[model samples]
Target chain A: MARIVVDPVTRIEGHLRIEATVEDGVITDAYSAGTMVRGFEKILKGRDPRDAWAFTERACGVCTTVHALASVRTVEDALGISVPRNAELIRNLMFCTQMVQDHVVHFYHLHALDWVDVVSCLSADPKETSRIAKSISPWPKTSPAYFAAVQNRLKTFVESGQLGIFANGYWGHPAYKLPAEVNLLAVAHYLEALEWQKELVKIHAIFGGKNPHPNYLVGGVPCSINTEEVGTINTERLNHVGSLINEAITFVEQVYIPDLLAVAPFYLDWASVGGGLPNYLCYGDLPTKSYAEIDSFKFPRGAILDRNLAEVHEVNGRDAEEIKEYVAHSWYRYERGDEAGLHPWDGETEFDYTGPKPPYEQLDVEGKYSWLKTPRWKDHPMEVGPLSRMLVAYASGHTDVQELVNETLGRLDAPVTALFSTLGRTAARGLETKLVVHWMKEFYDALIANVKAGQTRTFNDEKWDPSTWPATAEGVGMTEAPRGALAHWIRISGGKIDNYQLVVPTTWNGSPRDAKGRRSAFEASLIGTPVANIDQPLEILRTIHSFDPCIACAVHLYDPDGKHVHQVNVC
Target chain B: MTRESGTTIIGIGNLLMGDEGVGVHVIRHLERTAPPPPGTEYLDGGTGGLHLLEPLQARTRTVIIDATADGRPPGTVRRLTPRFSSDYPATLTAHDIGLKDLLDAAYILGDPPDVTLFAVSITLPSKLGTELSDPIAAVVPGMAERVLNELD
Candidate 1:
């Protein structure tokens, strides 16, 4: 038996350390640890509830608006405010736009290199790549000359001896299964996706005044519709948004989905691996009506227990017993004991670093190890994210979700059982992006119709002032972030935040084990995975990146040196 | 919208992490004290990643201000024209995507803008706070002036 530790996993949003104990070429046990500590909950204390969105929005650089959305919704939920229909439609548009754009960026930029071999693309015939690209989709950029140009660029980049970001990748690993022609084609789309994403984010800039950290109001959206005005969302801006939506739909359908389908067949065995937990959770989002109408959510809210698609248990964010967080294997001290669980409303953010100091070799996995607190749904560790959302929607009889899942499964010639693996998680992201791009059109048309009907109200100022107040109130805001289930709980006292807790997606999937010694998604998924070479564990990256781990959102602060501390030890 | 040409001065850092936000602070200072010349724009790129590519490509030149940990004094500032990713300082605050990676992506896509990087040395932050340290805060005006000079 040998223990392989990959510290500071590259190509992820933040620092994550994975330790796997391999026995006879297969992982017998795995431990996932989030090294950074997040202080957002501590920062929000004693501040006005209305201004919390601005601060919490900086939690993660990638999923900028998800935190802000949850923050504003929590404040509004506490204040008992109902925004206008137009504001709802505009928020929906932004939400769906974020989903579509984030998924595309994840698949192409962050997750693609794991499966693609840039060095092998140098050996590919551009004409063969062009032929494969043309046969896959009518994307119009499929000529042999285009493929050749992309290949030339890659050759120059590699031969320059300055691999930069690609420097540390296991390029010629045996785990890479794609053909050279397909690899070249995927490389071309990778560059194209980068350019496409920059243009796609203009929708956020148009409505929310900026991207990265778009402006969000407490009651409703920050932007007001004025078809004739120059500063607000006007006729010209509306047209720009319309065209961008159309372009997004085309890119996802023509480029993203096609690439996903093309690459999935080469690695069908992955469909049987990385199916971690038996339970799944999703706090559904994309409300067709107001947020109160749970039945109207495009992504229905529920939980799947024991991998039973036949039933999806009802999920409640406000119920204290429904969801609770424990710190048995985390660097936190609950006022009640480490073994006891506390709901978010009664959550605490005290830090107790009992693990090894920095620059240390191994972590005391038996003791407290990770920065992420273990969150259990009704005392059961549940997997969250795209797979959970898709499974819930499928079990709920959501027509569009069912159709997409069945169609993709049919194309791959796989069974419904395959929906529980890493491939399913990745394919679900692309399929949902397909559904969301079309929803963007629906939202845009709805906003236009409301404008034409002379209903231009975007903010409700009734609860804007703190004078109209209650003594103390507690509220929970739940939404489906691009990663998975996200909820922010707030307790307002004397118009100030008394306590605030955020249970993000990564905390559910990438967290350590609970008091029962059962593993969460990240650790459990790697238990049975095979490692071809202990020195270069490319297979581990394939399964982990499938979750699109966002540790910056999961764990917060960094090493005091601000330097990336990397280490790979084989013992 | 018509594409604006000329220089774009972009400041990249996390505003929540004390001196780590020197770039954003310098951008704000320049915006207030010295206005841009004609088509030059000021952008507060919070912990910049690939998103900086489009803005960089839209302009003919770009001036980036960021905090670096290069074993120098806290307030020391230096400027360089980095042609490749390896030229960037080893440590740029905690960001999902590093500046070097973003520059590399721009180079691969072709037509990378002429970039001038201004790096300020600082001790990496251990806690979260919005206010910059005294030493780093004292140099903000000087960094802004240098960026303005580069623009001119």
Candidate 2:
């Protein structure tokens, strides 16, 4: 018998623990166990559909927009309505800020430590670091003083902070092979990115409510803008957002991206690990509301499907059926492996954990490998998010999105087929950033024009009559969150929540064995990845963390008290 | 001690760890509400770090509002003027960076606040919730007013 313990898996949000069985120098099985539980969906049981926006943002701080969007879309689905274009733009702007913030924070603060050494910075030549920080041209707030300020901030943060992000960094790791200059440059930008992320969130607060968790409603946003007469974006507030975006893009293009490719060669073996999942799925993205529909809310609804790498289909949310949560090798008890499909609205929360049992496929079921119930798309796996969006947009011939992809692939010197792999998924994040940037600038003008036309109403004040809403309606609402695909299904009997089922992207990726005992996306993504050291598996984390696991989905921990039936002395 | 002089007032507590900073959050609300009863400094002496000890010791009277992990319903508010004997611990290191270190440091410096009053809000500092629970998050205005009336 052997013990497997992996705690605080580097490069993921919050914390994680994935234990696996290693036999004869090869790992046979593993479990993705989240150490925290955020009962947001459980708490959301009886609340009014409109209030979902205010509450669901608690799912995850990093991807609050997706939560807000999912909540809004769910209500929209229930009401059978769409938002206006101006409303969509405002929402898009809110989503853009989160994306930029999430990417910057992840690359610099969270994951950067895995690759860059903070302790190594003490040996750096400040003058050289200063020079590197200012090398980029046409900078917004770059000067000797600004660079010095950045250095000072990092100094205070590292010195005062308890958790050493600098500990076990790339300075001495065999995996860390980036240049000293690149390391120094990244450290400087890391400090700058923290300050930069806060500024970006101001747009969220100004448009929604406050940072971390914003409050935008269904039908549309609760906030609107008017600054066309001044011919400027309320500069005092939104300027920092625009400035941060400009600074971040430059840093990514000049420093970060280049440094990644340079250091990536050192970790080339990652390409093989967690790399062979070909199935992908996305629920499409938020629909852009039109000008004339300012008072009304309308959104795009599409179901996405893909296999191999080329062919993709965009289906309506209605066409998406056969959704089921199976708990075969799971710790929890369920009706059966092949049970009737239930929308999130009608999800059964009778959590009954019969102590781990032997898996029908593998005996590890006795301690059931994980707590996550497998979510299958029509008896198969489906990938979602940036990959899904990219596939769907290309298939639909969204000319601008396609053009952006071609340009990116041309510059990357990689084929469009790269868009389908893990690397492609990561690259597609950047592409979506560009797509949103283009839309952001365009939306600014549209917002201005719409305001000039006296369109202040973003939400429909008159709501659907309770009598009008179907008593036993089952509806699924889907939207592309910052992390990827997010959806919520509702089953209404006489109106109180009968069952609520949510298939977050993280759930799809981190799921355990279903009634059929299938490996989840994250598990499947992990199969091919070469695991060198069982103790320190950075490659495995990088691949999984790339999806940015939203652990708040269905994480549970229980006390170690249970009745003992029998004990056998084998010693 | 503050009754002897009406010259200065101080507000102190942590501002992070969500509700643990309720003291600072509440005092800031005080500053925002009515004018800080003249010569008042609404300082968010976060976690009451060492830097706050000397400054607070120099104040004539100081009001501290903080999240106290006493057994009570979340947001149950209490005001304590230091006593010789009580069930509660004399010092709290509830936060990683706590107020006890700052106040104790102030005592060590031999210049602790003359009339130091602590408004403890009984609440769970951990689990993330947007709204404040029952009494503590609810009693900010009243707490501030009580401090203001004492200062006046």
The lDDT per prediction is 0.86, 0.54
Residue range A1-571, candidate 2, lDDT tens digits: 1224454354444334565555543445666654433344555667666666655554443566667777777767766766766677777777666765666566665556665666555455666655655564334444556545545555654565422334333345455555555566667666555444544566766676544456777677876554542433343445555565565566556554544454444444443345445666666553454422322211222334444434544344444465556655445544543244443444555555554332122224434455566666667666666666666676555777788778766765666666655566666665666566555655555665676687656666555455656666665666666666677776555655455566677777777655555567676665545444544555555666666665544452121111111111111
DockQ values of all predictions: 0.47, 0.07
Give per-residue CA lDDT, model 1, range A479-552, as digits (tens): 98998999999999999999999999989999999988999999999989999988888888888989988888
Whole-model lDDT, model 1: 0.86
Which portions of model 1 miss their true places by more than 4 Å?
A557-571, B1-3
Q: Pick the candidate with the highest lDDT.
A: 1
- Candidate 1, residues B1-152, lDDT tens digits: the string is 23467998889877777777789899889888877889898888776466666777778888988888777889999898998878887554455466777788888887666899998888864357778989999999988888888865
- In candidate 2 the C-alpha lDDT for residue B146 amounts to 72
